[model samples]
Target: MASIQDEIKQTRPFPSPSAEAVVALMRTADMVRRSVASVVEPAGITPQQYNVLRILRGAGEAGLPTLEIAERMIEETPGITRLLDRLESKGLVTRVRCDKDRRRVWCRITTQGLELLRQLDAPLQKADEAALQALGNHDLEQLIELLDKARDVYRRIS
Candidate 1:
């Protein structure tokens, strides 16, 4: 394993342990994102689109409101409307205005979206597994717990 300093070719050390950890986390996240993008982008959709499709698929027949979908995204994105527009144009999803709440829009995964996710399912799983292949089961669990603990700072503020 390469040190963060070596991987980034940093001549100067991070000022603090927190700074080093933050940089390392961001770097690792970018690597994982690229790995996922390799799988999903070749299929014609970015990872974010894949995320939205999966969220809607999990919502089932009743579906979920547009805002709710945004809340559920793995990566927080401000342009969810544009994301939906792209997915809608691709014929992968549909949006219907709620009858009772004129301002609320319900989004649902189309049959095509479901089918696309189905095709990518196995490959996505493999990609995810390969990303963490270096970690044993116990280490993986500890990493998850540590990540959760790290996020407690944001949770407290929010």
Candidate 2:
């Protein structure tokens, strides 16, 4: 495995280990994201769109409010409305105003969205597995734990 410094072609030493770790984590995340995108994009939806569809599918027939979907997203996006608009235009989702609360809009995955997700499911799983295949289960578990701990600290400070 190439060290982060070598991969990034950094001749000078990092000022701190934390900075190095942060960069490494970011680089790895981008790599994995691209890998996932390769499997998803050809199906006509970006990864973010796929994420929204997955969330709505999990929400079941009742669906959820638009704000709730935003809160549940893996990557915080400021243009969720635009994201929904694109999906809606593609016939993958539908949004309707709440009867009781006129201001609240509920979003749901359509049959097409669910079908797309179903088609991608196995391929996405395979892509994810391949991305982490170099790591054993124990290493993956430890990595997850460390990431969770780091995120917990971030949440507390943020």
Candidate 3:
């Protein structure tokens, strides 16, 4: 019988032969995303939405500007208006026009949002555990370090 690697096609041949690492990250991130999303989606929020709320929770009840929140996100979203729109519509989050500057909008996670996030906590933990269960602690740490290093590869280019 073929080994496990023989049955899967995760990486195609790369001209430079070094693109395998990129392929692995893409595949692993994709798998983790799906697994994580499954756990969080039932809470009525996408990963991005949850992330925004989490950031707000950490930053305190005062909230953060939309552009600032976008800067802190893992991936670049299409600005923050639509995201806030969806979250607000769900009553999970709220947007307030800054009194000092009418053009500045700050986003605050509502009590409902916090409650939903609280409900999602245990399940999210389980989902993360399930996703990383195959790896040993040392291996997981190494993988995390590698991904972080890769992310910082071209600070100037990005």
- What would the TM-scores of all predictions be? 0.91, 0.92, 0.87
lDDT (Cα) of model 3: 0.85
- The regions of model 1 sitting more than 4 angstroms off are 1-12
| Deviation (Å) of 55 in candidate 1 | 0.4
Q: Candidate 3's residue-wise lDDT over 1-158, tens digit each?
A: 55666545435366354676778778988999999889888787899888888888887889998898998887788757898899999998889999999999988989998998889888889999899999999988998897778678866577
Ranking by TM-score: 2, 1, 3
Candidate 2 lDDT over 33-105, as tens digits, reads 9999999999999999999999999999999899899999999988999999999999999999999999999
Which candidate tops TM-score?
Answer: 2
- Pairs of residues clashing in candidate 3: none
Model 3 weakest 10-residue run by lDDT = 7-16
Candidates in descending lDDT order:
1, 2, 3
Residue 67 of model 3: what lDDT? 90
What lDDT score belongs to each candidate, Candidate 1 first? 0.95, 0.94, 0.85
Clashes of 2: 0
TM-score of 2: 0.92
User: Per the 3 Å backbone cut-off, how many clashing residue pairs does candidate 3 have?
Assistant: 0
Top model by lDDT, which number? 1
